[model samples]
Target: MVESLPQTRSVSAEAAAENRAWVSDLSSTGDRRELASRRLYDVLLRAARSEAGRRAARLRLAGPELDDIAHQAAADALLAICGKVETFRGDCKFTTWAYKFVIFDVGAKVNRHFWQRAGVAFDEEDWERLPARLGVGPEAHAESRDLMAAVRRAVDETLTAKQRTVFVALVLNGMPTDVLAEQLGATQNAIYKTMFDARRKLRTALIAAGYLQEHQPA
Candidate 1:
């Protein structure tokens, strides 16, 4: 015959008191702190991942490089969080601050990749020379497949042949002034003059063709 199992007793008052005390101690220090830290980690990780994905999509990065970029961005975000942990005043949410770090890290990574691929040197001289090389402002010309043709026509109709060649060599081809001078068998000063004349003529042509507007005489 099978024996009957003994019934379990309810928790005694003393045991319950000890359990409550243990729980209170844990809540006062370890458990609460662990919960807070876990929350912060979760929020930061989520923000970093979101920013990484957004940047990758914006830059149209594909394959393993995209993953590497995102990983690097996440690592940067975590490092920033650790460095600024002392300054977390709890005024705003930690996630909000983390999001800014994540975005900045991802943007910086993307810029570095693009600059490297394009062979752009980041210096004051390079910055100043950029407009002469890349043309005017960001939206200086309309986006079209026939943009080069239109630009050529504008140059031919407005500028002399030598000025047009100088403009193309220096601006579109990213040739240095010294190199352009050597190629054209002219002095750097002469190249500069040709570029200036080409710019003026092109501006006039653009304004006349309604591609650009004339500024109020100032």
Candidate 2:
């Protein structure tokens, strides 16, 4: 036989009084206690499993694991509500405050887990600098990788040691002109000229390899 769920108690007068006392304590410094409480409740409900799943999907978190992360974030939000009750000054909506806390908590948890498993510091500044130094976005990144692979093949087929070293240092390593000069034992002006020539040659090679096409300026 199936068991029935237990009935919940209705809000009694004594319970209501106790709640009012708690709220009054929370609003001690002339804050909008009612609004803050309401907003917190709304945020918690919105971050329920289904809604969080949708958000996680948008953020590209897939499979059963993402649900676990969402649940963890929801729990963290609830804990924050209890711990940060005094800190809620109602300067902004409680929902906004709760969301910031939840996102930070979830991101930290994920980063920690990844670092432990991979044995690497994923938050390195150099990792962030790589993409910006490449002058590429996510879409451009894929294309850039493909172009790099083709260039490597072409380099193996034809370029000499000094040419390959200069090309890799300036282009792939994203070294600045001054740094490239230091490494090559050349003047900054000489490094700049070499880089310009290397780029021209690579562009011509890439065009021949069908990796690039000329476009007219608008």
Q: Alpha carbon lDDT of residue 109, candidate 1?
A: 65
Q: What CA root-mean-square deviation does each model show from the true structure?
A: 18.2, 15.9
Query: How many clashes in each structure?
Result: 0, 0
Local accuracy of candidate 1 as per-residue lDDT tens digits, 1-218 = 11222222444455444433323332344666456545545565566566667655434566777667766777677666656554543333345555787777766666555423433223343334434343544464344323344555776677776775676556643556775675566899998988887777777765665555587110
- Candidate 2, 53: how far from true, in Å? 4.8
Lowest summed lDDT over 10 consecutive residues: which window, candidate 1?
Answer: 1-10
Clashing pairs in 1: none
Give the alpha-carbon lDDT of every model: 0.56, 0.52
Poorest stretch of ten by lDDT in candidate 2? 114-123
Residue 69 CA error for candidate 2 (Å)?
0.7
Error of 2 at 100 (Å): 2.0
Steric clash pairs (candidate 2): none
Q: After best superposition, candidate 2 residue 90: deviation in angstroms? A: 1.7
Candidate 1 Cα errors over 4 Å, as ranges: 1-45, 118-218
